[model samples]
Target chain A: MKDALAHTHARIQPYVHNTPVLTSHLLDELAGATLYFKCENFQRMGAFKMRGAVNAIMQLSVEEQQSGVVTHSSGNFAQALALAARSLGVAAYIVMPSNAPRVKKEAVLAYGGQVVECAPTLTAREQAAQQIVEERGATFIHPSNDLNVILGQGTAATELLAVQPALDYIFTPVGGGGLVAGTILAAQYFGRNCRVVAGEPATMNDAYRSWQSGTIEGNDAGDTIADGLKTQLGDINFPIIQQGIDAIILVSEDEIVAAMRLIWERMKIVVEASSAVALAALLKEKTRYAGKRIGIILSGGNVDLSKLPF
Target chain B: MKDALAHTHARIQPYVHNTPVLTSHLLDELAGATLYFKCENFQRMGAFKMRGAVNAIMQLSVEEQQSGVVTHSSGNFAQALALAARSLGVAAYIVMPSNAPRVKKEAVLAYGGQVVECAPTLTAREQAAQQIVEERGATFIHPSNDLNVILGQGTAATELLAVQPALDYIFTPVGGGGLVAGTILAAQYFGRNCRVVAGEPATMNDAYRSWQSGTIEGNDAGDTIADGLKTQLGDINFPIIQQGIDAIILVSEDEIVAAMRLIWERMKIVVEASSAVALAALLKEKTRYAGKRIGIILSGGNVDLSKLPF
Candidate 1:
């Protein structure tokens, strides 16, 4: 999987920015570790999801390109797929939950995506996406679940270790499990002996439960400020994650808020609540990775200041 | 000045992180121009002032180093000087205006500087600093006036252009003009024909007036949320700025606040009001550099979130 991801990196090189890495002295002291932050917040469409979306789009058959691609997401993936489709000169249709952030929908539309609003329920979103695929004959790019997307997203960790080869641990926020699986694959390929840990919100602890049970677990999806982490792990994503991921840690909403503010104040980086989930795990000192070289994936920076969680 | 700054860069390289340059697709679209943001917000003391302070402290003679250094600043320079001195194993005495933000004062103290709280008036701050210099045999490191300090500050622009040579224009928030002068010197050395513009708050338009008159102008201490830019330019800094700087543009307080929020929201980088001054200028759509490659010096990210400007 990691070798495939390294191959995908070459395929997606022209499409994505080699987003710069940043470090902070104050954050280092506070965290009690040397931290190299891979800033994916600077990625096209303002998140790392573009890597996977573009990778998946690029691999489709010429006939598939003619038919266009579709995805169901109200967050980063929707914008990623829309912008990737635009870049590839292909059509993109996105089915978004009606209750999704207005900013997310506007971004997708601004990027030339044909948006279809569905009910907030997952079933409705899936059904709407299916209908769009059936009617338009477009290929659906699952936000997670799919192997191509997961491998594509894992290149972030691959690139990190390429730059800072001595990294000891990689902390990432886990939601649908694609990001974690990708990270794990990269670490294994590099033979870095790097611990792969997931920072998840206590409100949405399906990933944590799934890791413990060795099977996909669905919990009551409670509301969290980290809206991106609300989804449960998929069947395909679950198995790879179970094999590769080392641990899952849960942080409370307040911890996420504090970590977000801490990054804003001390690290001087604007990270979304979902991105802050990893920082929250570090700040909570949930599982000690102190004195190690910690690499944090700052997932995205598309936050609404007008309605900040804190 | 450029040669002197090059010396500073060599001297200070060991202490400071060559802070990463961050780019934003969202910011580019909003400004209708490409932006390369040299993120000094990630510097040692969370600002570019560390570059200047470290160079100045390191260049001190043995006797002066043993005697320590003194300065009066109510902003980022205070913590920068403190941190630089501590890193160099030299003592720092910071005379801060009593009305300075509590967080700023605490940062100075936390960095191992002895803080002397004086009247908020400039005269009182100077008097307190002089008294300390006489009593403690400490050398005064002027915030912007000293040749060594300005030369040290110039290294920031030199480093920036080294990383981004194609910048067509460089925008920097003006306080006492040391940082801008340094940038101008660097641009000249790098064969960059880019205009060097200063971002100043409308309420504190002394720099703007000075640029127009071709002479230093004084303004009554004006209240601005960008507390760092409230001071007038210095004697040594004024001449260099007059000869080299392209223009000084004014940004309204509302624009400053808006830019600050926009940076936090869109760029996912936390910047102080002073740092946002350049962004505010861009938001105002100042002519002469439209559709050009603009490099903005995000001076620092030291805002106290407890009392957010908004």
Candidate 2:
């Protein structure tokens, strides 16, 4: 698993950006911690999803690559996979809900992916993607559940640790749990002393409940601005998270927006509410991490300009 | 003037950030030109005015520095001077109109500046600043007119050139004319063949009119999203600009907002409408510079979140 991340980083190196790590003095003061932000917002396709997508597509056999890859994602992963597949000269079939935003569909199309529309339901999306695997002989790449994707996603924290090895803690937003699981492995392998923490939206606190219950928990309230973290923890990544994650912080809707605004206003970086969840978690427990060195993976910076929270 | 800028860069190096130069391949492809953005929005106080502010204060004699500095600005410069003065252990008395936003005043105060409020008029702001200089024996630093300040602003271009010395053109937003004027000098000295272009709001075409008339001009309408570029060119920088600038482009309010949105959406960077003006100019004339390598001074990234144009 440790070698997998290093190999993944090397494989994805030719494609994705080694996004810059930035620090803001004011943000440090606000959090009461010396913070290093892994700016994955500037990643290819505007998110860290590219890291995983690039590694996933590049790992396929030549025959599988020719058959192409498929995934069901309405968020950053869809664009990430599309761009990654195109760069690898592989056709990508993206299963998106029929109600997905026009812009998102266009983005996938612009990246040369074939968008397969399905009923706006989890089962329907799964079935549609499975149909692509059955009919087109395409490999179905789970956005978070796949081991290769998890290893690739872990490289964000690996890169951060490489840049700031003295980090006392690494914080990530928990969604389908790939990022958090990968970060956990990265911190454990590279950081040695650094602990991994995860942040989840209060409304959709499935990750938080799952951590406490020692089982995957489901939440009905997908009513959060962090659209990226609404998904529940996946089976493959959840066990790793349970073993390695030091803590999980749940932040309110207001906290998420406020933190997002802070990053936008003070740090002068456009980060999605999902990215803000990590900072909001740190800020919520500022006293706990006071004077400590922390690293936060700013997952993505994609936002609809027409719908700013502030 | 070339020696002055080099000296200003060194003197202010300790107090100010040598900000990064960033490039977006997506943005470059959109504009049909390779664009290098000098990210001054990340400078202390979230603007390039920090460069000028630090330079102006550092040039003062020890006795004069102890007496402190006075400036009349309700914008980034107010906070810039405040932070610069506080960094150098000098007092900053900022004269702002009473009608200035409470947030702006609070920012100056947060940076350890004493705000002197007068009536909402240019005459009143000037009078209040003059009063401070008279009563406190403080040195009055004209935000853009001072030679040291203009030289300081030139360092932004100098740093950009140091990173990418083969730039064909440099664009800057023209306001009180300091940045454009300084960029003109930097390009002339450091970039032998690079031409300086200026961008201004079409509604406030004072700089454009001044360029055509060979004399200063003023416009009554300040109805534009680019608040930073509203001020007309001053005498000191205007002469340098007249002698050095190659072209000035006028952009509409829609164009400004659109350019700003492109930066936020594509680049994932928080930049004010003022900073977008330079990109707006290039985009407006994209066909003209199809494959040219251009350097744009992203002037600032201080935007009111509550009052976002998009």
Each model's lDDT comes to: 0.86, 0.93
Best by TM-score: 2
lDDT of 1 by residue, B1-310 (tens): 5567677788889998887787777788788888998888888878888888988888889899999999999788889999999999999999999888787788899999999999998899999999989999999998887767787777777888898898888899998888988888888887468778889999989999988987788886588998888778888888889998877889999999999988877777888899999989876874556688999999988877667865
Each prediction's DockQ against the real complex: 0.67, 0.94
lDDT of 2 by residue, B1-310 (tens): 6787788778888888888898998899999999999999999899999999998998899999999999999999999999999999999999999999999999999999999989999988889989999999999999899888999999999999989899999999999999998899899999959999999899998999999999999877677889987788888999999999999999999999999999999889999999999999999999988999999999999999999988
In model 1, the fraction of reference contacts reproduced equals: 0.82
Looking at candidate 2 chain B, the ten consecutive residues that score lowest on lDDT are B1-10
Q: What global local distance difference test value does model 1 have?
A: 0.86
Q: Give the TM-score comparing model 2 with the true structure, all chains together.
A: 0.99
The runs of at least 3 residues in candidate 2 whose Cα sits more than 4 Å from the true structure, single-residue gaps closed, are none
i-RMS values of the candidates, in order?
1.7, 0.6
Encode model 2's per-residue lDDT on A1-310: one tens digit a residue: 6787788888889998999999999999888889999999999899999988988888899999999999999999999999999999999999999999999999999999999999999999999999999999999999999888999899999999998999999999999999999999999888959999988998999999999999999987568999998788888999999999999999999999999999999999999999999999999999999999999999999999889999
